[model samples]
Target chain A: MKLNKTSRNFKILDAFYIAMMILPIIFGIVLQVLTKPVSEGIAITGARVYFTIPMPVQDFPITESQVNSAIVMVVIFFFCLYITHGMSKKIELKRQHLAEMIVEKVDSLVKENMGEYFMGFAPFIIAIMALSAFSSLLTLFGLYPPTSDINIVGGWAVLVFFLITYYKMKCGPINYLKGFAEPVALLAPINFISEFATPVSMAFRHYGNVLSGSVISVLLGSALAGLSSMVLGNLPGFLADVPLFQMGIPAVLSIYFDVFSGCLQAFIFAMLTMMYVGGAFDLETYKQKKARKSAKNKQ
Target chain B: MELAIGIILGCCALGTGIAMIAGVGPGIGEGNAVASACEAIARQPESKSSVTTTMLMGCAIAETTGLYALVIAILLIFVAPGLLVDLLVNTMNGLK
Candidate 1:
C-alpha cells in the first residue's frame, strides 16, 4: 500500500503518537504530586458514619449510605419530574418517546411474567427496578451506593418477602398455613426456615456482589500503586511517588465489576421478585374467592 | 497468650481461604449451563435472545451458593477474628 506521507490525517496520527508517549509521563507526575490516594491502605470497611443524633433512648448514627441514598432519591425524584413534565397527546420529543417506551416495556414485562390479573402490581415492580438499578449505578460516580449496604437491600428484600406472603395468603388462609408442612408433616420445620431464607439470600446476593467489586477495586488500586513505585522508583524527585501504572489499566476491570455486575444484580433481584410474588398464589382459587366475595355483595 | 491470639488470626485466614472453595461448584455449574445454551443457540439462532436470558437467570440462581460463601468468608476475614481475640483478652484479664 502507498502511504500518504504529508496528508492532514497522517500529520494528526503522527502528532497523536508523539503526544501519547510524552503526555502521560508529564501528566502522571503532575497529578501524583497534586493528589493522594483517597484511603491509605486496602481493607474492606463498612460505610463511614457522618454524625450521630442523640435521641430519647439511643444514638442514631448517620452513615455514608444514608447520605448517598438521599442523593439517589433526589436524583430519581428529579428524573421522574423531567419524564412527566411534558403532557401532550402526541409524542414529539425523543425524551417523551423514551419515557413512553420504558413504561410500555415494564408494563408488558410484568403482564407477561405475572399474568393479566396482576397488572396492578406494575408500579410497585417498576419502583423496585428503578431504585435498584439507579442505586447500583451510583458506584460510577464514586458515591457509596446504598444497595451495597445490607440494611438497604435487606429492607427491599423484606418488602418482597411480605408481598410474597400476602399473595400466597390471598388464595386461602388454610393452604397458606399448610404450605409450611409441604410434602409431609415432618418437613414443616425445614420448610418454615426456608421461607425466611429467601429474603436473606436475596439481600446477601446483591450486597456481596457490590462489596466484592469494591474490595477488588481497592486491592487492585493499591497493588498498582505499589507496583508503579517499584518500577519507577529511580525517577527524579517527585516522580517516584507517581502512580504511573494505574492510569488506564483499571478501567478495563471497572467496566465489568461496576457497570455490568451492578446492573445485572439489579435485574436479577427484580426478576426474582416478580417470579416469587407472581407464582405465590393459585390463580384459579384467588379469582374464585374474589368472585364469591363480590357476588355476595350483589346479593 | 500471644501464641493463642496469633493462632486465632492464622486459622481465620485459613478459614477464609477455605470458605472461598465454595466458589468452585458454581463456576463449573455455570460453565455447563452456558455451554448447553451455546449448543442450543447454534442449533436455532432465531431463539438466541430467549436462550441467553434463560441462561442468565439460571446462572444467577446457581451463583447464589457462591455469593453465600463470599459473605461467609468476608465475615470470617473482617469480623470474626478481631472479636474472638478481644473476647480472649478480656477473659484473660478477668482471670488476673
Candidate 2:
C-alpha cells in the first residue's frame, strides 16, 4: 500500500506531542536546580502529621506531620493522573482517528477478552506508564522518586480503596458489604481490614524498597571510592596509581544504582498495586458461579 | 591523607545519593498499575484472576530497570573487586 501524506503528517504530530510532554519535565529540572536547588538525597528530614483525632485511650500522639506523607502521595498520584488525562484528552481531540484506533484496539483486546471492566482501564494503564517513565527519568537525574515516598504510596492506596469501595457501593452497598461476609459474617471484619490494608501495604512496600535501595547506593558508592583511594595511595606505582581508573572502576556500580534498581522498584510497586486491586474485586466467586451454571446445564 | 580520604569517601556518598534520584520511576509506575488494576477489577468483577496475572507480569517487567541499579549498588558495596583491592592494599601498608 502507498503511504499517504496524512499518515506521514500524523506520525510527525505524534512525535511533536511526545516532545511537548517531555519538554516541561526537562525544563522543570533545570528551573528547579537554578532557583530552588533542591538537594538530591534520599533522606526523610521531617514529618507532617495530617489530622489529630481525640482518643480516650492513651497512645502515641497523632500529629499533622504523620499524615503529611499520605497527603504527598495522594498529591503525586493526582498530579500524574491529571497530566496523563489532559494529554490523552488533547491527543483524542487533535488526532481523533489515531486515538480512536488506539482505543478500539485496546477495547477489543482488554474489554472483550478481559471483560467490560477493562474498558476504561486503558486511561489508568497509560497514566501508570507515564508516571513510570517520569519517575525513572527523575531517578536518572538524582531526584527523589515521589513513588518511593510512603506518603505518595499511601495516597495511592487510599485512592485505590476509595475507588473500589465506590464501585462496590454503586453496584449495591448492602450486597457488596455482604460479599465481605461470604461463607461467614465473623470473617467480615477480617476481610474489611484486609481491603484497607491493601493500599497501606502497597504504598509502604514500594517506599521501603526504594528508600532502602537508595541508602544502599549511597553506602556502596562511598565505600568503593574510599577503597580505590586507599589502594592507590599505598601501592604508589603505575599499576596502582591511577585516579581515572579509580572513578572508572565504580561507574559499573553507578549503572546499577542509576538504571536497574530504579526501574525494578517502580515495576514492583505497580504490580503490587494491580494485584491488590484485583483481589479487592475477587475472582473466585465468579468462577464458582460460572461453574454452578455449567453444572446445571449438563444436568 | 586521612582528611583527603574522608572527604573523598564523603563525596562518593554524595555521588551515590545523587545517583539514587533516578528511583522515582518504579515507585509511581507501580502505584499507577495498582490504581488502574483496581479500577479494572471493580468494573469487570469477573476476570479478576486473569487481570491480576497480567498486571503482575507488567509490573515485573517495569521493575527490571530498578533491580539492575540495586544489583550494581550491592556489587559496589559488598562484592566489588575494587573494594577488595583497597582492603588488601591498606592491610599490606599497615603491616609495613
Candidate 3:
C-alpha cells in the first residue's frame, strides 16, 4: 500500500539495472554509427608485461596480473580498514554490523569445516577466500583476472599444500615417510607422486575454470562482432559495426561466469583446503591409533 | 615438404579433438554423483544443503581430468602448431 525507504531504494536499483542493460546496446549502436569497423583478432593471451627492469640473470617484468592484484589487495585493505574504523564496544552502526557479520561468517565457516582445534587457521582461510573471490571478480571491471593466471592460483595451492604437509608431519616424521609405503612397498613411488598431485590438481582446476570462462567470453564477443559485420555488410557504416549480438548476451554470461563461478570456485578452494588439512588431523583415528600403540608397548 | 607441414598441422588439430574424449569419463562420473545426490536429498530433505555441497565438491574434483584435457587442447591448438611450423621452416631453410 505504501513505499518504505528500503523498498524505494530497491526500486531505484531495479531502474539502474534496467538502464545498465539497455544503455550498452544503445551506446554500441551510436558508437557503430560514429567509428570505423575494426575487427580485432581474438586470442586468449596471458597477462601482458607493462614494463621490465633489466637484470643480469633475468629481467624483472611487471605484468597485468601483478599490478591488478596489488590494486585489488590495496582495495581490500582500505575496505577492511573503513569497515572497522571508529570502533565501539557495542555494535551501534551498520558498518559495525557488517564488520561483525563478515568475521562471524568466516569464523563459523572455518570452525565448522576444520574443527575448533584449528581455529588458528580461520584468519588464513579468510585471507585466501577474500583474495581469491576478489581477484576472480575483478574481470567484471575489465581487468585481467588474476585467477586466470596459473601462477596466482598455483601459488595459493602450493601454500595450502605446505599447510597440508605440515599437518601430516605432525603425526611424526617416520610415520609420515612410512605413509608413502602403506599396504605394500611396491606402491610407494605411486603414493609419493600422488601426494604431489594434490596441489597441481587444485591449481589447474581453479585456473582452468576461470580461464575457460574468459576465453569463451572473448571468443563469443569477437564472433558476434564478425557475424554482425558480415550480415550488415550491405548496410551503411553504422549497421555494419553494430555488434548487436554481443550487447544482448555477454551481460548474462558475465553474471554467471564472473559472479557465480567466481564465488563458487573461491568457496570450493576454501572448502578443499579445510577438508585436506582437517583430514590430516583426524583426532578420533589418531587417538585410537595412539591408544593401540600404547597397549602394544605395554604388552 | 609443404604437404608434410599441412599434415602435421592437421594431425595436431585431430589430436586436440581426440584429447577432448577425456571429457567422457568425468561427465559420466559427475552425472552419477549428481543423480545419487538428488536421490539422497529427496530421501532426506533436511540433508539438502550438505548433499548439495558434497555433490558440487565431487563434481569439481571430477572435472579436473576434463579440464586437463582442455588445457592440453588449447596448447595444441595455439602453441604446438606455431612452434612446429616455425621449427620445420627453419630446418628446411638450413637444409637449403
Candidate 4:
C-alpha cells in the first residue's frame, strides 16, 4: 500500500497520539506497583487527590495536582530539548519546522495583545499556555490537573500581578501610587478592590473551569461504573469486573472537557496575562524613559 | 435527628440547583457578544482576527458572573453539607 504525504503525516500523528495515551497509563501502573502503599495522609475525593510529600526538612502533604504539574513541566522541558537538539541552517528539519511554527504563533499572539514593545513576553506567554493546557489535559490520563487546584492557578495569577505591579513601579513609583487616587480620591477603596479583583478573578476563572470539568467527568465515570456493576454484578468471574458502560462513553465527554475546554482555558489565561501586564507599561512613559537615558548619555 | 439532617441535605441540593440559574444571564450575554462579533467580522472581513480576539476577551470577562455562581454552587454542594452536618450534631448534643 502507498500513502500520500498528507496520509503519511496523519499516520505518524496517529501513532504519536496512541503512544501519548498509552505511555501515561503504563507509567501510572508501574509507579503504583513499585511504590509502597502509605495510607496515612492520603485521600481521594472526586477528582481531587492529596498525597503527603516526604520533604527532607518536614513532611508536608501536597495535592496530586502539584505533582502532576511538575510532571508536565519535566515532560515539556525534555520535549523541547529533544526537538531543538539538532539543527541545519540550510534545510529545515521536521522538528525545526514545528518549533519555528510554534515560536511564530506565540510571537504573533504576544505582539497582537501586548504590542511590539512587549514582544519580549512571548516566551512567558507560551510557557503559561503550554503548561496550563498540558496540566489540564493530564486529567485524561487519570492524573489530577493542577489548574483544578486553586493554589496552582492562584500562584500563576500572583506572579502576573507581581509583574504588573513591578512594571508600574518601574515606570514611576510615586506616580503609580498617585494614579490610584486620580479622578477622585473617594473612589480609591473601590479602585483598590477592582485592582485586587484582577488576580483573584483570573485565578478562580481557570481553577473553576478546570475543576468543574474534573468534577463532572468524575461524576459521570463513577455513575457509569455504578450502572455497569448494577447491571453486570450477577455475572460470574471476570465478567462481573467489566465496567461495560464506562468503556466508550467517557471518551466522548473527555474530548470536550479535557481537550477543548483545557485548550480554551489555557488560551484565556495567557491572553489575560498578556493584556494586564502589557497594559501596565505606558508607551509614553517608555518613550520618556528612553529620551531621558539618551539625554544623560549626551551630558 | 436523621430527619433534620435529611432536610438540611435536601434544602442544600435544591439551593445549589437554584443558584445555577445565574448561568442564564452569562449564556445570553455571551451569545449576543458573539453575534455582534460575527456581524463585525462580516462587515470587515480583513479585521476578523482582531475582532475575534476582542470578542474572546469580552466573553471571558462576561463569564465571571457564571463562574461566581459555579463557585457558590460547588460550596453549597460539597463544603456546606459537612459544615451543616457538624452544626446539627453539635446542636443535638447540646439539646441532650
lDDT, candidate 4, A160-191, per-residue tens: 99998988787778778876897899988888
Q: Name the lDDT value of residue A228 in candidate 2.
A: 65
Candidate 4: TM-score?
Answer: 0.81
> How displaced is residue B1 in candidate 1, in Å?
2.3
Candidate 2 residue-wise lDDT, A123-220, digit = tens: 66445544543554465554455555556556766876786676555434566878789779899888888777666655555555565656656666
Query: Please, what are the lDDT tens digits per residue for candidate 4 over residues B1-96?
Result: 899999999999999999999999989999999999999999999999889878988998898889989989998998899999999999889999
Pairs that collide, model 3 = none
Candidate 1 lDDT tens digits, B32-70:
999999999999999998898789889988989999999
True contacts kept of each: 0.70, 0.10, 0.65, 0.55
> Could you tell me how far off, in angstroms, the CA of residue A62 lies in candidate 1 after the best superposition?
1.5
Chain A only: give the TM-score of model 1.
0.82
- TM-score to native of every candidate shown: 0.87, 0.50, 0.83, 0.81
CA lDDT of A286 in candidate 1?
71
DockQ class, candidate 2? incorrect
Q: Could you tell me how far off, in angstroms, the CA of residue A100 lies in candidate 1 after the best superposition?
A: 0.6
Q: Which stretches of candidate 4 lie over 4 Å from their true place?
A: A1-29, A32-59, A222-247, A289-299, B90-96
Q: Local error of candidate 4 at A277, Å? A: 0.2
TM-score of candidate 2 to 2 decimals: 0.50
lDDT for each residue of candidate 3 in A47-104, tens digit (9 for 90 to 100): 8776799999999988767766776676666667656754578554477888888889
DockQ ranking, best first: 3, 1, 4, 2
**What is each candidate's DockQ, to 2 decimals?**
0.70, 0.08, 0.76, 0.58
